[model samples]
Target chain A: MKARVHVMLKTGVLDPQGEAVRHALGAMGFDKVEGVRQGKVIDLELAEGTTEAEVAEMCEKLLANTVIERYEIDLD
Target chain B: MKARVHVMLKTGVLDPQGEAVRHALGAMGFDKVEGVRQGKVIDLELAEGTTEAEVAEMCEKLLANTVIERYEIDLD
Candidate 1:
Protein backbone atom coordinates (compact mmCIF):
# COMPACT_ATOMS: atom_id res chain seq x y z
CA MET A 1 0.00 0.00 0.00
CA LYS A 2 0.98 3.61 -0.52
CA ALA A 3 -0.05 6.69 1.37
CA ARG A 4 0.51 10.35 0.76
CA VAL A 5 0.19 13.19 3.21
CA HIS A 6 -0.21 16.84 2.40
CA VAL A 7 0.65 19.14 5.24
CA MET A 8 -0.13 22.82 5.11
CA LEU A 9 -0.18 25.74 7.47
CA LYS A 10 -3.48 26.94 8.84
CA THR A 11 -5.17 29.81 7.00
CA GLY A 12 -4.56 32.47 9.63
CA VAL A 13 -0.99 31.51 10.44
CA LEU A 14 1.93 33.55 9.14
CA ASP A 15 4.08 31.86 6.54
CA PRO A 16 7.29 33.75 6.20
CA GLN A 17 8.81 31.27 3.82
CA GLY A 18 5.85 31.49 1.48
CA GLU A 19 5.91 35.26 1.71
CA ALA A 20 9.55 35.25 0.72
CA VAL A 21 8.79 33.17 -2.33
CA ARG A 22 6.01 35.52 -3.39
CA HIS A 23 8.31 38.48 -2.97
CA ALA A 24 11.03 36.81 -4.95
CA LEU A 25 8.63 35.95 -7.73
CA GLY A 26 7.55 39.55 -7.95
CA ALA A 27 11.15 40.69 -8.09
CA MET A 28 11.81 38.17 -10.83
CA GLY A 29 9.06 39.72 -12.98
CA PHE A 30 6.28 37.27 -12.22
CA ASP A 31 4.06 40.18 -11.32
CA LYS A 32 0.88 38.23 -11.88
CA VAL A 33 1.63 36.03 -8.90
CA GLU A 34 -0.64 37.35 -6.17
CA GLY A 35 -0.03 34.86 -3.39
CA VAL A 36 1.98 31.79 -2.53
CA ARG A 37 1.60 29.09 0.07
CA GLN A 38 4.09 26.33 0.52
CA GLY A 39 3.40 22.90 1.90
CA LYS A 40 4.94 19.48 2.29
CA VAL A 41 4.03 16.21 0.60
CA ILE A 42 5.21 12.97 2.09
CA ASP A 43 4.85 9.74 0.11
CA LEU A 44 5.09 6.53 2.04
CA GLU A 45 5.39 2.99 0.81
CA LEU A 46 3.72 0.88 3.44
CA ALA A 47 3.33 -2.81 4.08
CA GLU A 48 0.25 -4.18 2.38
CA GLY A 49 -2.81 -4.12 4.63
CA THR A 50 -1.74 -0.88 6.31
CA THR A 51 -4.98 0.97 6.77
CA GLU A 52 -5.93 4.60 6.21
CA ALA A 53 -6.44 4.94 9.93
CA GLU A 54 -2.82 4.01 10.51
CA VAL A 55 -1.67 6.62 8.00
CA ALA A 56 -3.81 9.24 9.66
CA GLU A 57 -2.33 8.25 12.98
CA MET A 58 1.15 8.69 11.56
CA CYS A 59 0.23 12.17 10.39
CA GLU A 60 -1.19 13.08 13.75
CA LYS A 61 1.69 11.63 15.71
CA LEU A 62 4.64 12.91 13.71
CA LEU A 63 4.01 14.20 10.20
CA ALA A 64 1.97 17.23 11.10
CA ASN A 65 1.99 19.81 13.87
CA THR A 66 -1.75 19.90 14.48
CA VAL A 67 -1.56 23.15 16.43
CA ILE A 68 -0.61 25.18 13.36
CA GLU A 69 -0.83 22.85 10.41
CA ARG A 70 -3.48 20.68 8.80
CA TYR A 71 -2.82 17.42 7.06
CA GLU A 72 -4.75 15.32 4.56
CA ILE A 73 -3.97 11.68 4.03
CA ASP A 74 -4.54 9.77 0.79
CA LEU A 75 -4.30 6.01 0.70
CA ASP A 76 -3.74 3.73 -2.25
CA MET B 1 -6.41 31.56 -11.59
CA LYS B 2 -4.48 29.17 -9.42
CA ALA B 3 -1.49 26.94 -10.03
CA ARG B 4 0.15 24.23 -8.03
CA VAL B 5 3.66 22.92 -8.42
CA HIS B 6 4.86 19.67 -6.92
CA VAL B 7 8.62 19.46 -6.69
CA MET B 8 10.33 16.19 -5.95
CA LEU B 9 13.86 14.90 -5.94
CA LYS B 10 14.86 12.71 -8.85
CA THR B 11 14.69 8.98 -8.34
CA GLY B 12 18.43 8.49 -8.20
CA VAL B 13 19.02 11.43 -5.89
CA LEU B 14 19.69 10.81 -2.22
CA ASP B 15 16.94 12.27 -0.03
CA PRO B 16 18.46 12.64 3.40
CA GLN B 17 15.43 14.37 4.81
CA GLY B 18 13.17 11.51 3.74
CA GLU B 19 15.56 8.98 5.19
CA ALA B 20 15.54 10.83 8.47
CA VAL B 21 11.77 10.80 8.53
CA ARG B 22 11.66 7.07 7.87
CA HIS B 23 14.13 6.47 10.68
CA ALA B 24 12.10 8.58 13.04
CA LEU B 25 8.91 6.75 12.10
CA GLY B 26 10.57 3.41 12.79
CA ALA B 27 11.76 4.61 16.18
CA MET B 28 8.23 5.79 16.83
CA GLY B 29 6.90 2.28 16.04
CA PHE B 30 5.68 2.61 12.46
CA ASP B 31 7.42 -0.57 11.38
CA LYS B 32 5.18 -1.01 8.31
CA VAL B 33 6.64 2.08 6.71
CA GLU B 34 8.97 0.71 4.09
CA GLY B 35 10.03 3.87 2.30
CA VAL B 36 9.46 7.58 2.37
CA ARG B 37 9.98 10.51 0.03
CA GLN B 38 9.49 14.11 0.98
CA GLY B 39 8.54 16.78 -1.51
CA LYS B 40 7.22 20.31 -1.75
CA VAL B 41 3.90 21.63 -2.97
CA ILE B 42 3.62 25.29 -3.82
CA ASP B 43 0.23 26.83 -4.40
CA LEU B 44 0.07 30.08 -6.29
CA GLU B 45 -2.79 32.50 -6.69
CA LEU B 46 -2.33 34.14 -10.04
CA ALA B 47 -3.94 36.86 -12.06
CA GLU B 48 -6.85 35.60 -14.11
CA GLY B 49 -5.70 34.21 -17.42
CA THR B 50 -2.19 33.32 -16.28
CA THR B 51 -1.15 30.53 -18.61
CA GLU B 52 0.19 27.09 -17.83
CA ALA B 53 3.27 27.81 -19.90
CA GLU B 54 4.13 30.68 -17.59
CA VAL B 55 3.75 28.41 -14.59
CA ALA B 56 6.04 25.84 -16.19
CA GLU B 57 8.64 28.54 -16.82
CA MET B 58 8.47 29.55 -13.18
CA CYS B 59 9.07 25.98 -12.13
CA GLU B 60 12.06 25.68 -14.40
CA LYS B 61 13.65 28.96 -13.41
CA LEU B 62 12.95 29.25 -9.72
CA LEU B 63 10.72 26.64 -8.15
CA ALA B 64 12.74 23.50 -8.87
CA ASN B 65 16.38 22.63 -9.38
CA THR B 66 16.27 20.99 -12.78
CA VAL B 67 19.49 19.08 -12.21
CA ILE B 68 18.21 17.11 -9.24
CA GLU B 69 14.51 17.76 -8.97
CA ARG B 70 11.49 17.50 -11.20
CA TYR B 71 8.32 19.55 -10.99
CA GLU B 72 4.77 19.05 -12.16
CA ILE B 73 2.45 21.99 -12.67
CA ASP B 74 -1.29 21.84 -12.25
CA LEU B 75 -3.45 24.77 -13.20
CA ASP B 76 -6.86 25.29 -11.74
Candidate 2:
Protein backbone atom coordinates (compact mmCIF):
# COMPACT_ATOMS: atom_id res chain seq x y z
CA MET A 1 0.00 0.00 0.00
CA LYS A 2 1.00 3.58 -0.49
CA ALA A 3 -0.06 6.52 1.63
CA ARG A 4 0.22 10.25 1.02
CA VAL A 5 0.07 12.83 3.76
CA HIS A 6 -0.51 16.54 3.35
CA VAL A 7 0.56 18.57 6.35
CA MET A 8 -0.32 22.21 6.55
CA LEU A 9 -0.21 25.01 9.04
CA LYS A 10 -3.42 26.02 10.79
CA THR A 11 -5.19 28.97 9.27
CA GLY A 12 -4.34 31.36 12.06
CA VAL A 13 -0.67 30.50 12.29
CA LEU A 14 1.92 32.77 10.75
CA ASP A 15 4.02 31.23 8.00
CA PRO A 16 7.19 33.16 7.49
CA GLN A 17 8.46 30.86 4.76
CA GLY A 18 5.28 31.32 2.77
CA GLU A 19 5.48 35.02 3.37
CA ALA A 20 9.02 35.06 1.98
CA VAL A 21 7.86 33.33 -1.16
CA ARG A 22 5.03 35.78 -1.63
CA HIS A 23 7.45 38.66 -1.27
CA ALA A 24 9.80 37.09 -3.74
CA LEU A 25 6.97 36.56 -6.20
CA GLY A 26 5.92 40.18 -5.92
CA ALA A 27 9.46 41.29 -6.55
CA MET A 28 9.58 39.06 -9.62
CA GLY A 29 6.51 40.89 -10.95
CA PHE A 30 4.03 38.06 -10.39
CA ASP A 31 1.76 40.64 -8.90
CA LYS A 32 -1.37 38.52 -9.25
CA VAL A 33 -0.23 36.53 -6.23
CA GLU A 34 -2.24 37.68 -3.25
CA GLY A 35 -1.36 35.04 -0.70
CA VAL A 36 0.74 31.95 -0.25
CA ARG A 37 0.83 29.07 2.20
CA GLN A 38 3.53 26.42 2.08
CA GLY A 39 3.19 22.91 3.41
CA LYS A 40 4.65 19.42 3.23
CA VAL A 41 3.66 16.31 1.34
CA ILE A 42 5.06 12.96 2.36
CA ASP A 43 4.60 9.89 0.21
CA LEU A 44 5.04 6.63 2.06
CA GLU A 45 5.43 3.17 0.67
CA LEU A 46 4.13 0.76 3.24
CA ALA A 47 3.88 -2.98 3.68
CA GLU A 48 0.65 -4.61 2.62
CA GLY A 49 -2.34 -4.28 4.93
CA THR A 50 -1.24 -1.02 6.50
CA THR A 51 -4.32 0.76 7.86
CA GLU A 52 -5.34 4.40 7.59
CA ALA A 53 -5.65 4.57 11.38
CA GLU A 54 -2.04 3.49 11.70
CA VAL A 55 -1.02 6.24 9.32
CA ALA A 56 -3.04 8.76 11.27
CA GLU A 57 -1.26 7.70 14.43
CA MET A 58 2.06 8.27 12.74
CA CYS A 59 0.97 11.78 11.83
CA GLU A 60 -0.17 12.54 15.34
CA LYS A 61 2.96 11.14 16.90
CA LEU A 62 5.68 12.34 14.58
CA LEU A 63 4.65 13.68 11.23
CA ALA A 64 2.68 16.74 12.25
CA ASN A 65 2.67 19.19 15.11
CA THR A 66 -1.00 18.89 15.99
CA VAL A 67 -1.03 22.15 17.92
CA ILE A 68 -0.33 24.39 14.95
CA GLU A 69 -0.60 22.12 11.95
CA ARG A 70 -3.12 19.70 10.51
CA TYR A 71 -2.66 16.62 8.35
CA GLU A 72 -4.73 14.70 5.85
CA ILE A 73 -4.03 11.14 4.74
CA ASP A 74 -4.86 9.38 1.50
CA LEU A 75 -4.31 5.70 0.80
CA ASP A 76 -3.63 4.00 -2.49
CA MET B 1 -8.42 31.94 -8.23
CA LYS B 2 -6.23 29.45 -6.41
CA ALA B 3 -3.28 27.44 -7.62
CA ARG B 4 -1.49 24.57 -5.97
CA VAL B 5 2.04 23.52 -6.79
CA HIS B 6 3.47 20.22 -5.73
CA VAL B 7 7.24 20.19 -5.91
CA MET B 8 9.04 16.90 -5.57
CA LEU B 9 12.51 15.55 -6.07
CA LYS B 10 12.81 13.58 -9.27
CA THR B 11 12.90 9.80 -9.06
CA GLY B 12 16.34 8.31 -8.16
CA VAL B 13 17.40 11.46 -6.37
CA LEU B 14 18.71 11.18 -2.83
CA ASP B 15 16.15 12.29 -0.24
CA PRO B 16 18.02 12.43 3.03
CA GLN B 17 15.18 14.02 4.95
CA GLY B 18 12.81 11.26 3.93
CA GLU B 19 15.40 8.65 4.84
CA ALA B 20 15.73 10.18 8.27
CA VAL B 21 11.97 10.07 8.75
CA ARG B 22 11.80 6.44 7.74
CA HIS B 23 14.57 5.64 10.19
CA ALA B 24 12.75 7.46 12.94
CA LEU B 25 9.51 5.63 12.18
CA GLY B 26 11.40 2.35 12.42
CA ALA B 27 12.78 3.44 15.78
CA MET B 28 9.24 4.18 16.88
CA GLY B 29 8.25 0.63 15.87
CA PHE B 30 6.33 1.49 12.70
CA ASP B 31 8.04 -1.36 10.96
CA LYS B 32 5.61 -1.50 8.04
CA VAL B 33 7.11 1.66 6.57
CA GLU B 34 9.12 0.67 3.50
CA GLY B 35 10.05 4.09 2.12
CA VAL B 36 9.26 7.77 2.39
CA ARG B 37 9.70 10.68 0.03
CA GLN B 38 9.12 14.24 1.20
CA GLY B 39 8.07 17.15 -0.92
CA LYS B 40 6.52 20.62 -0.79
CA VAL B 41 3.01 21.87 -1.43
CA ILE B 42 2.61 25.56 -2.10
CA ASP B 43 -0.91 27.00 -2.27
CA LEU B 44 -1.28 30.35 -3.99
CA GLU B 45 -4.21 32.71 -3.82
CA LEU B 46 -4.28 34.58 -7.08
CA ALA B 47 -6.20 37.43 -8.55
CA GLU B 48 -9.23 36.73 -10.70
CA GLY B 49 -8.69 35.38 -14.22
CA THR B 50 -5.23 34.00 -13.50
CA THR B 51 -4.35 31.42 -16.13
CA GLU B 52 -2.84 27.98 -15.58
CA ALA B 53 -0.03 28.87 -17.95
CA GLU B 54 0.88 31.78 -15.70
CA VAL B 55 1.12 29.43 -12.75
CA ALA B 56 3.28 27.01 -14.72
CA GLU B 57 5.55 29.85 -15.62
CA MET B 58 5.82 30.74 -11.95
CA CYS B 59 6.83 27.19 -11.18
CA GLU B 60 9.40 27.16 -13.96
CA LYS B 61 10.88 30.51 -13.02
CA LEU B 62 10.81 30.44 -9.24
CA LEU B 63 8.78 27.77 -7.46
CA ALA B 64 10.83 24.76 -8.52
CA ASN B 65 14.42 23.96 -9.41
CA THR B 66 14.14 22.18 -12.74
CA VAL B 67 17.57 20.53 -12.41
CA ILE B 68 16.57 18.35 -9.46
CA GLU B 69 12.90 18.93 -8.90
CA ARG B 70 9.66 18.66 -10.84
CA TYR B 71 6.44 20.48 -10.13
CA GLU B 72 2.78 19.85 -10.86
CA ILE B 73 0.37 22.73 -10.98
CA ASP B 74 -3.34 22.57 -10.21
CA LEU B 75 -5.53 25.57 -10.74
CA ASP B 76 -8.88 26.16 -9.13
Candidate 3:
Protein backbone atom coordinates (compact mmCIF):
# COMPACT_ATOMS: atom_id res chain seq x y z
CA MET A 1 0.00 0.00 0.00
CA LYS A 2 1.04 3.57 -0.57
CA ALA A 3 0.26 6.61 1.53
CA ARG A 4 0.90 10.22 0.65
CA VAL A 5 0.97 12.78 3.44
CA HIS A 6 1.15 16.50 3.15
CA VAL A 7 2.34 18.48 6.17
CA MET A 8 2.22 22.23 6.31
CA LEU A 9 2.38 25.19 8.62
CA LYS A 10 -0.87 26.02 10.29
CA THR A 11 -2.61 29.10 9.11
CA GLY A 12 -1.35 32.31 10.76
CA VAL A 13 2.22 31.09 11.01
CA LEU A 14 5.00 33.16 9.50
CA ASP A 15 6.99 31.38 6.84
CA PRO A 16 10.22 33.15 6.17
CA GLN A 17 11.41 30.41 3.87
CA GLY A 18 8.29 30.74 1.77
CA GLU A 19 8.70 34.45 1.67
CA ALA A 20 12.26 34.03 0.43
CA VAL A 21 11.08 31.73 -2.29
CA ARG A 22 8.43 34.20 -3.28
CA HIS A 23 11.04 36.91 -3.57
CA ALA A 24 13.27 34.63 -5.56
CA LEU A 25 10.49 33.83 -8.01
CA GLY A 26 9.73 37.48 -8.41
CA ALA A 27 13.34 38.03 -9.31
CA MET A 28 13.09 35.12 -11.71
CA GLY A 29 10.25 37.04 -13.41
CA PHE A 30 7.13 35.31 -12.11
CA ASP A 31 5.69 38.57 -10.97
CA LYS A 32 2.06 37.48 -11.28
CA VAL A 33 2.60 35.66 -8.02
CA GLU A 34 1.26 37.64 -5.13
CA GLY A 35 1.46 35.14 -2.29
CA VAL A 36 3.56 32.17 -1.30
CA ARG A 37 3.38 29.55 1.41
CA GLN A 38 5.45 26.39 1.80
CA GLY A 39 4.76 23.07 3.46
CA LYS A 40 5.96 19.44 3.22
CA VAL A 41 4.87 16.12 1.72
CA ILE A 42 5.70 12.65 2.97
CA ASP A 43 5.35 9.52 0.84
CA LEU A 44 5.14 6.14 2.44
CA GLU A 45 5.38 2.69 0.95
CA LEU A 46 3.60 0.93 3.73
CA ALA A 47 3.14 -2.71 4.40
CA GLU A 48 -0.06 -3.86 2.75
CA GLY A 49 -3.21 -3.28 4.82
CA THR A 50 -2.08 -0.13 6.56
CA THR A 51 -5.22 1.73 7.45
CA GLU A 52 -5.91 5.41 7.03
CA ALA A 53 -6.46 5.74 10.76
CA GLU A 54 -3.05 4.23 11.37
CA VAL A 55 -1.45 6.83 9.15
CA ALA A 56 -3.42 9.59 10.78
CA GLU A 57 -2.32 8.35 14.16
CA MET A 58 1.25 8.32 12.98
CA CYS A 59 0.91 11.90 11.83
CA GLU A 60 -0.36 12.95 15.23
CA LYS A 61 2.19 10.93 17.13
CA LEU A 62 5.37 11.53 15.17
CA LEU A 63 5.09 13.13 11.77
CA ALA A 64 3.67 16.51 12.58
CA ASN A 65 4.29 19.27 15.07
CA THR A 66 0.67 19.86 15.83
CA VAL A 67 1.33 23.18 17.49
CA ILE A 68 2.66 24.62 14.26
CA GLU A 69 1.42 22.38 11.48
CA ARG A 70 -1.44 20.30 10.21
CA TYR A 71 -1.43 17.29 7.87
CA GLU A 72 -3.59 15.75 5.19
CA ILE A 73 -3.33 12.18 3.96
CA ASP A 74 -4.04 10.45 0.65
CA LEU A 75 -4.10 6.72 0.12
CA ASP A 76 -3.17 5.11 -3.17
CA MET B 1 -11.02 30.90 -5.59
CA LYS B 2 -8.49 28.70 -3.86
CA ALA B 3 -6.04 26.12 -5.04
CA ARG B 4 -4.26 23.53 -2.97
CA VAL B 5 -1.04 22.44 -4.55
CA HIS B 6 1.11 19.56 -3.52
CA VAL B 7 4.62 19.30 -4.91
CA MET B 8 6.90 16.37 -4.36
CA LEU B 9 9.98 14.56 -5.53
CA LYS B 10 9.71 12.11 -8.39
CA THR B 11 10.32 8.47 -7.71
CA GLY B 12 13.98 7.40 -7.74
CA VAL B 13 15.18 10.78 -6.56
CA LEU B 14 17.33 10.75 -3.45
CA ASP B 15 15.72 12.92 -0.81
CA PRO B 16 18.30 13.36 1.89
CA GLN B 17 16.05 15.59 3.92
CA GLY B 18 13.33 13.00 3.89
CA GLU B 19 15.77 10.33 4.90
CA ALA B 20 16.86 12.49 7.77
CA VAL B 21 13.27 13.00 8.81
CA ARG B 22 12.62 9.28 8.70
CA HIS B 23 15.61 8.67 10.89
CA ALA B 24 14.47 11.38 13.23
CA LEU B 25 11.04 9.84 13.53
CA GLY B 26 12.62 6.50 14.26
CA ALA B 27 14.59 8.09 17.01
CA MET B 28 11.39 9.58 18.36
CA GLY B 29 10.11 6.01 18.87
CA PHE B 30 7.63 5.60 16.04
CA ASP B 31 9.14 2.26 15.02
CA LYS B 32 6.15 1.02 13.03
CA VAL B 33 7.16 3.70 10.58
CA GLU B 34 9.09 2.18 7.75
CA GLY B 35 9.60 4.98 5.21
CA VAL B 36 9.42 8.70 4.64
CA ARG B 37 9.49 11.11 1.71
CA GLN B 38 9.15 14.85 2.10
CA GLY B 39 7.79 17.39 -0.36
CA LYS B 40 6.01 20.76 -0.27
CA VAL B 41 2.58 22.32 -0.45
CA ILE B 42 1.67 25.76 -1.71
CA ASP B 43 -1.75 27.29 -1.06
CA LEU B 44 -3.04 30.02 -3.29
CA GLU B 45 -5.94 32.33 -2.62
CA LEU B 46 -6.70 33.23 -6.16
CA ALA B 47 -9.09 35.80 -7.44
CA GLU B 48 -12.36 34.05 -8.31
CA GLY B 49 -12.63 32.53 -11.82
CA THR B 50 -9.06 31.26 -11.97
CA THR B 51 -8.98 28.31 -14.33
CA GLU B 52 -7.36 25.00 -13.53
CA ALA B 53 -5.14 25.42 -16.55
CA GLU B 54 -3.91 28.77 -15.34
CA VAL B 55 -3.03 27.32 -11.95
CA ALA B 56 -1.27 24.41 -13.63
CA GLU B 57 0.63 26.83 -15.82
CA MET B 58 1.72 28.69 -12.72
CA CYS B 59 2.87 25.46 -11.19
CA GLU B 60 4.85 24.49 -14.29
CA LYS B 61 6.30 27.96 -14.60
CA LEU B 62 7.09 28.75 -10.98
CA LEU B 63 5.61 26.63 -8.18
CA ALA B 64 7.29 23.36 -8.99
CA ASN B 65 10.62 22.21 -10.30
CA THR B 66 9.46 19.66 -12.85
CA VAL B 67 12.92 18.15 -13.16
CA ILE B 68 12.73 16.99 -9.57
CA GLU B 69 9.05 17.01 -8.73
CA ARG B 70 5.44 16.51 -9.76
CA TYR B 71 2.51 18.59 -8.61
CA GLU B 72 -1.22 18.09 -8.05
CA ILE B 73 -3.70 20.92 -7.83
CA ASP B 74 -7.09 20.98 -6.17
CA LEU B 75 -9.59 23.77 -6.62
CA ASP B 76 -11.89 24.78 -3.79
Ranked candidates, highest DockQ first: 2, 1, 3
Positional deviation of residue A65's Cα in model 2 after best superposition, in angstroms = 0.7
Per-residue accuracy of model 3 over A1-76 as CA lDDT, tens digit each: 7888888888899989778867876797655556778887788877777789988988898788999999999999
Please list the residue runs of candidate 2 whose C-alpha ends up more than 4 Å from where it truly belongs after superposition: none
Residue B32 local lDDT, model 1: 100
Q: Model 3, A31: alpha-carbon shift in Å?
A: 7.1
Q: Between prediction 2 and prediction 3, which has the larger DockQ?
A: 2
Error of 2 at A49 (Å): 1.1
Across B38-58, the per-residue lDDT of candidate 3 in tens digits comes to 888887766667788888887
Of candidate 3 chain B, the 10-residue stretch with the lowest lDDT total is B24-33
Each candidate structure's TM-score, on Cα atoms with residue i matched to residue i, is 0.97, 0.98, 0.76
- Model 3, docking class: medium
**Candidate 2 local lDDT, B8-76, one digit each (tens):** 999999999999999999999999999999999999999999999999888999999999999998888
Which residue pairs in candidate 3 have backbone atoms (N, alpha carbon, C) closer than 3 angstroms, thus clashing? A41-B39
Candidate no. 2 TM-score: 0.98
